[model samples]
Target: MSLQQVEQIISILNKQSKPYEWVIQEFHKVDELKDFDLDLETFELLGLAFYLNQDNCLSLKTRTTKIKEETFCIVDIESTGGIKHGQILEIGAVKIKNSKELDRFNTLIKVDQIPENITELTGISFDMVENAPNLKQVLRDFKLFLRDSIFVAHNVRFDYGFISKALHECGLGILLNRYICTIEFAQCCIQSPKYKLDVLKELLGIESIHHRALSDALAAAEIFKYCLSKLPYHVQTTEELIKFVKTSRTQRKIAI
Candidate 1:
């Protein structure tokens, strides 16, 4: 088994009713070089440790069944304006694995500039952002959070394009992660004439609580879950889902 799988199995065992601590202690009882010296009945002792533990073996078996599934980091951003040229004011993302929300990343960012109208609209004044982390720092943390998962967002090009640009400006390389656009995913699954987030959320009964970074991120995560429920099993892997995202029928424009 992979090391991560081993770690997860250990975690599961720690939470269960089984005598896992005793099993771990039994393994420790055999000193590293001592086992080699104990040339006393090699095959018998080998069978002893391996056979005295049905619980340890069963925990591993359960976790192996779970390793085939993949996870996604659903994201959303609230910016000063709709344009990619406009700076992002806040960002939020949630990791979903095996139908569970596992991790989260969220932050408000300091922007280089913000117009009075944007300040009025988003309540994100320049002074408010002055002390916040710059895009570079924020992107660094975001990159660590995103590590190799499928990225999902509503109107994904807008969020993804701005993120790619921000990361590039920070001297970080472009993110080539497989991505899924909820707007397009909905269009494909539900055939909506209009797939705006609020529109689709209202139509589908997925409520948007705050519409700010975390709230929108949660809503987008729900939308992504809905899309996943509709997709076939073949599109389950991160790479395969990215392929589906790339071929989505929605018209997405690349920001200049």
Candidate 2:
């Protein structure tokens, strides 16, 4: 589809003032998108616009001039765990530029089988996700969801590690995006002894619903925002913040 057609869809989306999902549904009805195969840039742009409409995130505006226009995708995964590697049952993420939510995506991933204990803990039964999109499709969709954005998560390393491994196993390239761990930033910025999401949420008074993908994404986004507010002024740009996070462990090692 032509950019003009996409632009028109975006325009309609911008004017809708509806919830994000409704807008997505409406946009899908557009003639161009009916059979649309979005090129990478178009998909990213569309995704950004999708999140700009969120009420919770509208208050945090992007200062594009102050930092690189590079976006950040805050991610959370739900899985069957404590193995060498485990099955990812769900994926959730929200993109942010400046401080505003740009776009979001969440998907349930169908695995060949789910363990019994795994089903109990997560309430994600094998039958529930049986007809859901497989890992390959979900990852492809997520990679598109995250295009041009730095990957971020609470602990961050685990989410990125799991995703990197999953993508590689699917014959897709590992994500080369820069990343920051909110947990690391929390250690640097907050005095809490523990940084688990629920613990930190209680300490910060950021109420969150548990286990669901979008809820977890929202909680991670909140934690990230709190950390951003606490960072030193010198670490203003995305590049500078990345450097600070990269060197944070070195500083801790020296102190130890």
**Top model number, lDDT:** 2
Q: Which stretches of candidate 2 lie over 4 Å from their true place?
A: 1-65, 249-256
TM of each candidate vs. truth: 0.64, 0.69
Segments in model 1 whose C-alpha atoms lie over 4 Å from true places = 1-68, 82-84, 209-211, 245-256
lDDT, candidate 2, 112-139, per-residue tens: 7778887776677877897999999999
After superposition on all C-alphas, the RMSD of every candidate to the true structure, in Å, is 14.5, 12.3
Q: Return the TM-score for candidate 2, rounded to 2 decimals.
A: 0.69
The number of the candidate with the highest TM-score is 2
TM-score of 1: 0.64
lDDT value, residue 126 of candidate 1: 78
Q: Please give, for residues 65-164, the per-residue lDDT of candidate 1 as tens digits.
A: 2213665778988787765457888999999887698999988899878888777655667787889998888988888778656678888877877886
- What is the Cα-based lDDT of residue 61 in candidate 2? 19
